[model samples]
Target: MSAPQHPTETASTAEATSGAVLSPVPDDVDTAPTELPDADPDSADAVVEPVDATGGADGAGGTDALLVTEGDVAGDYLERLLDILDVDGDIDLDVEGDRASVAIVGAELQDLVGSDGSVLEALQELTRLAVAQSTGVRSRLMLDISGFRAKRRADLTSLAGEAARRVAASGQPERLAAMNPFERKVVHDVVAGITGVHSESDGEEPNRRVVVLPDR
Candidate 1:
C-alpha cells in the first residue's frame, strides 16, 4: 500500500516509495539524523543539521553546505505541494546552527498541523525526500507547519524539566511514555541540560521510550 501523505511518514515512506532514506537514523528528528537543541527563535544561528549517515535504516552522507541546499529544495517542493492541495500558505526558510529550517505560515494550517502535529511530521519527511531526490544526497530538511514545532519545543522543554525533577527527587529513573523520534529528541535535549540528570532511549522504534536518569 502507498504511504500516507503526512510529513512523519515511516522509513518505508521513502524506502518503499523512493527507496532512498535520507537520515542516518530511522528518521531525522524526521529530517536531522542527530537531534540538537533547537536554536532560539529569537536567535539567528544556523540551526540545521544533516541526517547522520550512521543512524538510519539506510543512510547517506552529505556536506555542510548541503544543509542550505535542502532549504531551497524543500521550499520549492512545499510550494508545489500546497498548490496541489489547494492550501494557501507562505514558505519561510532559515539556516540555524547547522540545519535547514522551513516553516509554512500565514494561513489556516490546523488540518496540516493535524492531531498533535502528526500530519506536519509526515509532510516534513516527504519534503526531505524531495530535497534528497533533487540533490542526490540525503536531506535532513526540518519542516515546520504553522509554527507548531516552535510551540511544541517550548512545551517539551517544560515537560523535560518536570520529568528531571521527579527523577532527581526519587533517585529513580523516570520512564516517559513512548514518543516519536522528534518528541523524544525534545525531551533528550532538555534532560541533557539538567544537572545530575541524563536521558537515553530504551526500546525499539515506534514503541521506543525515553528514560530520565538522575545522577546516583
Candidate 2:
C-alpha cells in the first residue's frame, strides 16, 4: 500500500466533484510562511489562541487600519479567484466593527458554494490566511458568497434562539449536533445573547458539538 496523504496539506490542492482548489498562495501574498507565536510547551490547549476581541472598532482595541488592510487583501484575492475560475463577479469590501467582510455578487458564482457550503468554508479559511499573510496579523474577516452564509446565519440564529427558549422552559441542556468551528461560534453567540442560557463546545473537531446549557 502506498503512504497515506495528509488531508490538511493535500486537500486544498485536490480536485473533487466541484471546482479545483485555487492556488493556496495568492499572488499578492508573500512567499514566506508566517512565523506564528510558539506554542506553550506545557499545555495541550496552547494550540488555540484567544481571539483578540478587545482591539479596534470591532472591539479588538487595535488600529482600524489593520482591518482595512485585511479587507483590501481579501478583495484582491477574491478577484483573482473569480478570474481563475472563469467566473464573473464583483467583490464588495467593508469593515464591520473590527473585522473585514468581503462579499461576492454575480449570477455565475453559485457553483463556488458547493453542496452544504463545503467549498465556501475552505475558501473562507484560505482568504483569511491570505489576509493574515499580507498584514502579518491574524484576521477573523467573514467571507460571504451569494448570500448563502448570510442566509445560513439567519437560520442558525433562529434555531439557536428557539433552542435557548426551549432550554429555559425545560431546564434541560440541549446538545446540538456536530458542527464546524464557525457554526458552533454562531450557535454559542446566539444562545449567549439570550437570558438563562450558555453554550459550550464539546468533542473533537469534525464531530465536535455545541451544548446549550442552563445558566447556573
RMSD in Å for all candidates: 12.6, 15.0
- Candidate 1 weakest lDDT stretch, 10 residues: 8-17
Model 2: per-residue Cα lDDT over 1-216, one tens digit each? 111111110111112112311122224432221112221222221232333444344335455666667777888888888888888877777776446677776687667877677888789889988977776666777777777666666666767788778877876666666656556566667876788867665557666656666666
Q: TM-scores across all candidates? A: 0.70, 0.70
Clashes of each: 28, 12
For model 2, the local distance difference test gives: 0.61
lDDT minimum window of 10 residues, candidate 2? 5-14
- Local accuracy of candidate 1 as per-residue lDDT tens digits, 1-216: 111123321111111122111222232132211333441222212233334453232323344456656777888888888889898887877765446678787568788877766788788778877876786655556777777777666666666788788776876666666666666667778887878777766567666666666665
What is the TM-score (0 to 1) of candidate 1? Answer: 0.70
Deviating ranges (above 4 Å) for candidate 1: 1-64
Q: Give the TM-score of candidate 2.
A: 0.70
